[model samples]
Target chain A: MIDLLEHYAVAIMAILLGVVLAMFLVLIFFAILNRLWHNRGISRKREASESIQPLIYSYLDGSINRSDFAARLKNKHDITATWESIEIMIDNLSGEERKKLQMLLDLPPIKKHFLRKLNSRKPISLAQACVYFSKKTLTDKSIAVRLSVLQEHSYNVIAYAATLALVNTTNQGFRDMALLRFLLRKNNASMAVSDIIFKYYDISDDKEVAAEKLEFFVMNPDIPDKTRAAVIRMFPELGFYQTADTLRDLLQINVKNDPTGELTAALLGVLIDFSDQKLREIVEKHRLWESPSREVRLKVPGVYADIYGEETTRILLGLAHDPELEVRMAAQRQLLKHRPLISESRFEPDISTEWRAMKKSGDADVSNG
Target chain B: MSQKVLIIDDDPAVSNFIKYRLSKKSYQVKHVDNGIEGLDAIRDFEPDLVILDMMMPGVDGREVAEQVREHGLIDPNRIIVLSGKKMTDEIKALFDIGIHDYIQKPFSIDLLLLRIERALASLKSR
Candidate 1:
């Protein structure tokens, strides 16, 4: 028993010593491998920095554009340090060198940083930065940044930021109108646009600074067509009389291409507000009251009422007999307001029970054509 | 109970208009500027009805509605969606999430109050 115990003790000591030695060797192996990896990584980074130095120097010297810088540095991998260096380089650039740096910094990351900062800060600097970048003809990036801001921020912030940013760019007045349109595209956002109009234009009274700005935007062809179309749509609300000829031209041109009922309706609304004599003349010439587009038909009566006053019932009497059910329904609504006093001649031949008679007519027209 | 109603919209004008009208009818009203505060106020104020605006920064009104339903915070029936823009898909989306009524902006205050009264009265009858 004593001999067996002695052998067991020796075996235990050997196992403990073996484990300690193995652990020490393993630790040393890991430490060496880690050191080697660290050295290799450092050397690779240094080599990369040396390789990127020319691009950086060129960028700082104002030879390359911002998009190219973003593309070149995209794969440079050391984002944090790289951006810091780029920012520092941007700060040192002189004259046109500064412009080039500004252009190069127009990448998404830089813009995203601006967006983040704008959310928490006053945004005046970001707006100025955007304008500075925009003047260098950075349309693609500038537009993308502006759109993102529009989609993601409060309308007030977007309006304030975009308005300031547009001040230095070409056709800046037009850009503001486009931004407003984008901001206020949906049914819910009309009120906000109206608020902006009220704040800027006093729309109800027909004398607002915002109205003059919109007029300037309309006259600027340097603005894109889409933005122009949107501004034209808002013209009636602002009651810009100078655009009457422009509005008539647009309405005539627009009627040829499916008569965008909503826009026509809006234009009609404006002309009604202005009580322009030309409005009735154009409607009579185009036969817009009986036009295929429900949008135009719905709009005609309001203008007719506004132009001839509510007592002049001739156009409304004619409109009441129109074939398009929606138009007839709209006429009916107008007639209903005058109520009990409506002439028997204006009574429809067929008062169909279908609730969506106008909707059905629209569908039929679409299918037949 | 005061029949308290809360409005959560980013548009100050909208929230103010609703607050002013609802208070005139003697309904206790509270307003919050965005969805995050809106959610927090729901817990603290515990309004009888909530008028939610659909679009906002960070967390939108739809997500706020979803959170309310998932957590059983506000009664699903008492929520009214207020928007200036109308998209059928959005309406269907809100409907699927359990919003009971919707009102478009630039509304007549009289019409809105009537709808609220009807919705609340209908709920009581149920």
Candidate 2:
């Protein structure tokens, strides 16, 4: 029985060693293959850069006409190189040069090449095609339809790229549908979302229509608070001060109910940019300076300073004694930054002492530096 | 003698395009891919006008411009910045260092040629 067990153990050990040796040899083979493929790619890129780039430059400079340039791009290699050159030129050149390049995209071979890429099963290839289409002005209904179908792709990146491509189209319905699909996606309230919306807003010919669409998103309670806050922040940046009253109303309703303070802070932050006497009255009525959320209170001093200017000294003096260090520091900084419209005689003795101490520390830091 | 212009942009597409265009206009043009070579070319090539790109991998256009001004290798006004950045405080500060002009990227080749002509003309006048 002992001899039989030893023989079985030795046989197992031999098989394991053979398997390991096979794997090692396979890895070496792959490494060599990979290096050869890498070298080939590098050489091809070099050849393209050297040979095709000059022909493109010539065509652009009008030394050689379009047909002559097209005739030179005979093989798959030449076409690929020309495509690469076109991508670089399109990105870095604009005005008349960009128009010339855009005309190049309409060429049958180039258009067909990219259209085939759009139908590719590879996610990267499909995404690249979507981005390329996004850059060009599209009149093809079939391309838009393909993009719309790709918008539902299982891969998030491909779907997002497809959505962006659809948004670039001139069709309002397509743009609205794509944006809605994007915004309604679960947990999609991100900076990228804000950027896409901003781009959509920027491209809209009718500013009013775009603003109304944004306001719809802001007012919709179904939208997540973070997403709403992002949309609200866009208003002031985009010069949509017309939404000031609506934002103030939202703040009034949500301030007491807001647990995270994000919505309140966003509303306060934007309203500060549109600061006025009416805003001050609303802020004072809401008692936002004493709000439980430190983030909301932090914006209060700036709001007060903008509306009250030097007269903010009194309020800032009161705030400088607040429980939160950040709030106190914010109020103190405001006091030092602007001279009071009110005279020094009006300051309470303790408040005056606190102001003097803050000023001394600020000066000491500056001089020390 | 043709006036010499040195291009210090990292993008070969941009630099090559400018070189081809400028060579057509009979200006002696040379391009370097980074700031260190740019500074060396500024000294050795001694081009009359330098077309500097603002953003680069190491020692950016601003630093190169600052070094040039600091070393007094060339007149700060002989440098024109080609940037993709909008008119911000930083770009404004570049002008404070006395670069000749700032052209935003995605610029028309024609506009660039025009600006190059004007910059060279201004340098000649001075």
Candidate 3:
């Protein structure tokens, strides 16, 4: 037993010694690696700035065009550091100087540099490329290729950056418009594009032009699905001049394509949020569940209680027996959510005999459709 | 006797660009990179117009503009505040202080130059 105790202590000490040794090696290795990285970063930055300063100063003096200034990158040391310094300058200026910097980004050499980095298999490289594309609101076909690759990449940051780059580069400063159309219509990929618009883009620009452009793009079918839905979700934030008639027209147009109830609910919610007398009357009289999309049919019950009194509760009551389980469940959920709002004195449409007559008159067909 | 325009901004690039541009228009421009120094320049340069920035590390543009106006160091109407940090209330407050005009940063130099001429002209009329 004493011999076993001695052996166990030896075993414990061996394990402890191994852990301590491993930790010491790891600490030393990382310390050396960090110092090397730091030194290399400093020297690389120095080299990049040293090579570019003369050209930049000359450009400032109006002695050189942007193409000639950007062309100097061909002889660069540490392209990353060089790009970083140029990016800082771009961010620092505004008006014509900033516009000139943006033009430089589109120069063939710089574009080639970015395009090459955009195709790199690593996620960080892709992210950086996306960021550069966003800076000038650049729209390029080659960058689109990188976006496609990034769409399938496993990294979340790269995926997000790629989408924003696509939106920024292609959306033509109508991110609010594009995001709303695609965001609500497709009901996916909303958060990333929304974040980019709210975070990066200046919202204080000309609202009239933005509104007109937003209206045009939202009405453009060729735009991607997610982008259109994003635009739909972005309506309130766009702060455009909205009439109930426009919302009504928008609903009529949007309902045609809605494959699910989500769009109907969203459009109706928009109608409720931006309430209008004519729109409310239209909602009160119209059979909302007449939408072909089951998703739209499911949304009718949820929105019905807001438009009319308990007499119109028959609409939901009729929908309770919908053939699609999804629609019936949706009705049940709406009934519970809106139970408090139900009027104690039901409307003419709520009478038992009137309900029965309505039930027999193809009301189910309206919900099913 | 070129009209003196004192530019108060922390960004050297912006201030230098404005100074070089305004010099071509025959406005003698003096630039200081922060608010405290700007206050001193407002008193010393006796500028016909002062281009101020809203934000800085110490002695912000608002405070400097307020002090310049309140203490009678410069005509409040000769002060033109430039800021990217825009707020309607802040702009109204500057206007209430009788500052000359406001320009958002990243502004057009031509527009800024024109505004300065108008501001200085208004001062001359006064």
Q: Which candidate number would show the highest TM-score if scored against the true structure? A: 2
Task: State the displacement of the C-alpha of residue A257, model 3, in Å, after optimal TM-score superposition.
Answer: 20
Model 2: per-residue lDDT, tens digit, A173-242? 7888887776656555467576777768977888899888888777777777887887788787689988
Considering the two chains of model 1, state its CAPRI-style docking category: incorrect
lDDT of each: 0.61, 0.82, 0.67
The reply for model 1, stretches above 4 Å from the true place, is A1-213, A216-227, A236-265, A275-278, A306-325, A345-369, B1-126
- Sort every candidate by TM-score, greatest first: 2, 3, 1
List, residue by residue over A1-369, the lDDT tens digit for candidate 3.
Answer: 999999999999999999999999999999999999999878877877666655554575588987677656754363554456556556545677667667666767666777877888777777888778767665566566657566556676666666556656544544454343333333235676566544433543555656565566656657554565565566665544373466567677766566654545556655555644454444445566565567566656655545555545667766766779788766655554555666534645444443345444435555676
DockQ list for all candidates? 0.02, 0.69, 0.16
- Model 2: TM-score for chain B: 0.97
Interface C-alpha root-mean-square deviation, candidates in order: 23.4, 1.2, 3.6
lDDT: worst 10-residue window of model 1 chain A: A197-206
**Cα RMSDs of all predictions?**
18.7, 4.0, 13.0
Residue-wise C-alpha lDDT for candidate 1, range B65-97, written one tens digit per residue: 998999999877779997766567888888988
